[model samples]
Target: MRLIQQLIHQAVPDLNGRTFERRSARGIIVDGTKILLIYTERYNDYSFPGGGVAENEDLIVGLHRELAEETGASRTKVLQEFGYIDEYRPHHKPEYDLIHMESYFYVCEVDCDFENVQPEDYEIANGSYPVWIDIAEAIQHNRKVMANQEPSMGFSIARETIVLELVERELLGKASAV
Candidate 1:
């Protein structure tokens, strides 16, 4: 992990001494009209199954690994990169400087049965379950989760923006057709 961090610093010389900067990656796993979501035990909110990128790993590779680890969805093809979300949280204490992270979004196809899927060990440690819900239903449920339940659901910029980006692209495609 330390080696990867060093590599990242070498690759992106602009980053400061923030080796363990708070980082995350989310996999937008689409299966027909339904998308895969993970119901987290800790937060009791649902989001797409994916997690943080390793120290030196490429974003795409980390995304693939995360998706597979979370949803057992090994066969996935990344379709498009939807923008990114840059946010920060307090480091050790509220008085400290914020730890910044930029989460990249990718739309992808996966072939897995949501019901039978098992989250990998790390996901089990996080207490998450793979679930497939209709896109519209998932969005509405996520809104509720964000508003009333888990804060992560609503606070996840990557999840929110990725969905919006995909919807916007779809709408644009439709408009161009007419």
Candidate 2:
């Protein structure tokens, strides 16, 4: 997969340790002028509808699982992939030091017969919920997030912001190249 983007921690210095690798699958669901997104007030940001791939789990299967768990989109179809994003950051904990996350992104469509979201404990606690926002609104929200003092899950926020811009340019018929 191509590296669509990379997000690195700004204030945190890069550690001189071996980078731990984590792989995940994400979905991009767009409908007309709005797009499906997962919002986390704890982080004050939005992300694509997807999650981490479990041990020995196939990427495709993991994607379906994540979509169901995160958005409850049962009647869904996976379209073409946009690409992958690489995010490198210092581990939230001290011992791990450097951590690199490779997230695979795909274009997906969902039908009307979708189920309720089954969010994780952290998500429920942190108010992670779904929303369909106008593309313009999403772009503006992303910009606001970028200008904030400190973003929770800064890597995810920064990368999502970039992806939203790219999506807007392509789908909205914007001439600006990503």
Candidate 3:
């Protein structure tokens, strides 16, 4: 295994004994009435602002780093962990025959200045375009644009899980109703 892979496996051994590998983390950054999303060509969906956890990096720290790297917003704060989603991709990485990844999701908060946030060039090339959408609209867009067969497949559940919970908790207020 590569050095980073070894370190990551060690860090998230919960994935041990599984058929596939890799663990990642993401955040649902809600700034007022707008939730931060990333447009990705790979997934062909609008999704949250987070990414994989680097070797030996703390999950929360990775969330912050990915948020900033992808969304250009460094001051965001994690409010609570929402849940985890599992995805199986046959050709995600050519090196591996298959990729089974578990992505941890968190609900986060950022100031209202996210409207002008910019995605990094590398991220953009990787198909990430930062956009803010109302929570309900985001959920609909995610369902419509995602590549999942089942409503719960891939990162689909994690996509709307946090938002639904937050809405139930009244964090999203009236915007939660769309």
Candidate 4:
């Protein structure tokens, strides 16, 4: 997959010390101007419908699992790779100094009818739920959350916003002509 961007959180200390590496996969499912996303009420922001890949698990398999778990999506067919985002941030776990995350994104298609949605416990506590929202609206909402520095905002908002813009430009053909 291509590298879309690398982001270092402002709080990350400038050190090349111990780090924990994590790999995640996210899906981009679009229908006209709307996109399938996970809306976390606590954060008041949206994210892709996927999560961390388990050890030695195939990226696509993990993506499918995450899709089903988070959004009850089925019959998902991956169209193509949509690049990735590399991010570095302070780790919440004391075992690591920082966390280096590589998030892989793929363009995909899924059944319109969702069922049996079963998000992880933490996700449920966070009030995360699947939603189909306009791409521009999601982008604008995320940008606002970021601008206001919302206390409940999750770490993925910036990455999600950037990816949403890329989707708008490349997939939706909504980019401004220069």
Candidate 5:
């Protein structure tokens, strides 16, 4: 996959520090101008429907698993690789000083009908739920959250917002032009 962007958080001092590397797969499922996203009530922002890929999991497999688990999405077909975001930030776990996260995004198609969603405990606590929202609306909502710097805001907000903008410009833009 191509590299979309590389972000270094304010908390990350240097690249030479000890870090825990994590790889994630994010799905960009678009239907017209609407995009499937996870809205976290606690954070008041929207993000893609995907998560961390297990160490032994293939990226595509991870993407499917995450989509099913988070959004109850079925019959998902990856249309193409969108891109990825490389991010370095402070590790929440005490075992590592920093975290290097590579979030791979794929453009996908999924069945309209959804089943039971099984978001992780933390996600549930954060009031995370799936929804198909207008892409522009999601982007605006995230920008508002970031601008306010709300106490409940999560670290992924910036990354999610940037990717949403890219999707709007690259995917939606092309589609509209056609």
Candidate 6:
């Protein structure tokens, strides 16, 4: 899959410190004009349904597995490669650590028959749940979250906001016309 986007943050990190790199795979699952999103109460924002790709796991397979784990989608069809984003920032709280992350994205559609998603304890405690919302609404809300500037979700929400707009302008545009 070709890289569609690259994002960089200007925050300078400690010259001599630990650098953490995390690679994640996220999904843009849609049905009609509605899109699936993960809502994190801790940040009071929304995000795409995905997480870190396991070592040695193929991108597509990891995404499929993540969808099943995060949204409990019984089945999913990989529609297209959406894009990719590279994020850079100083680690929250731990100032000496610089966090660099690569997020791979894809468009997908989930078939019905979902079970309870198996989420970690933190997710359950934080009220992180999946919800379907209009692409426009998703874009609006994500932008709001970004605008509010919550430290935890600010950067991530900004990236998701971009994806939402693109999916709305491109994918939803075509789907509506059809």
Best by TM-score: 4
Clashing pairs in 1: none
lDDT of 1 by residue, 1-178 (tens): 1111111211243544443465566677665666677776666556766778877888888887777777777587888775556554434554534455667767788765555465668667767788777666655555556556454443453355345435434633321111
Better of 3 and 6 by TM-score: 6
Least well predicted 10-residue stretch by lDDT in candidate 5 = 169-178
What are the per-residue Cα lDDT tens digits for candidate 4 across 1-178? 8999999999987748789888999999999999999999989999999999987999999999998888887678999999999999989988889989999999999874556788889998989999999999889889889999999988889999999999999999997222
Q: Which residue segments of model 1 deviate by more than 4 Å?
A: 1-20, 92-96, 113-122, 149-178
Ranking by TM-score: 4, 5, 2, 6, 1, 3
* Candidate 3 per-residue lDDT over residues 51-76, each given as its tens digit: 77866888888887777767777487
Winner by lDDT: 4
lDDT of 6 by residue, 1-178 (tens): 6665666655744334676777888988888888889988887777899888876888888888888888998888888887888777677766437777888989888863346588878788888888888777777776766667766665577677767777777787833221
Q: What lDDT score belongs to each candidate, Candidate 1 first? A: 0.59, 0.78, 0.60, 0.90, 0.90, 0.77
State the TM-score for model 2.
Answer: 0.88
Residue 93, candidate 2: Cα error in Å is 2.0
Query: Where does candidate 3 stray beyond 4 Å?
Result: 1-20, 41-44, 111-122, 146-178
Better of 1 and 2 by TM-score: 2
- Of the pair 2 and 3, which is ahead by TM-score? 2
Candidate 2, run of 10 with poorest lDDT: 169-178
Q: Which 10 successive residues of model 3 have the least lDDT summed?
A: 1-10
Q: What is the C-alpha RMSD of each candidate to the true structure, in Å?
A: 8.2, 2.5, 7.9, 1.8, 2.8, 3.7
The clash tally of candidate 4 reads 0
Cα lDDT for residue 22, candidate 3: 64
Q: TM-scores for all candidates?
A: 0.66, 0.88, 0.64, 0.95, 0.94, 0.84
* Tens-place lDDT digits, model 5, residues 44-101: 9999999999988999999999988988876789999999999999988888899899
Off by over 4 Å in 4: 176-178
Cα lDDT tens digits for candidate 2, 1-178: 7788777777448646767778899888888878888888887888888889976898878888888888888766888878888888877766677788888988888752235788889888988888888867776776677776553644577788778788778666653322
- On lDDT, the stronger of 2 and 4 is 4
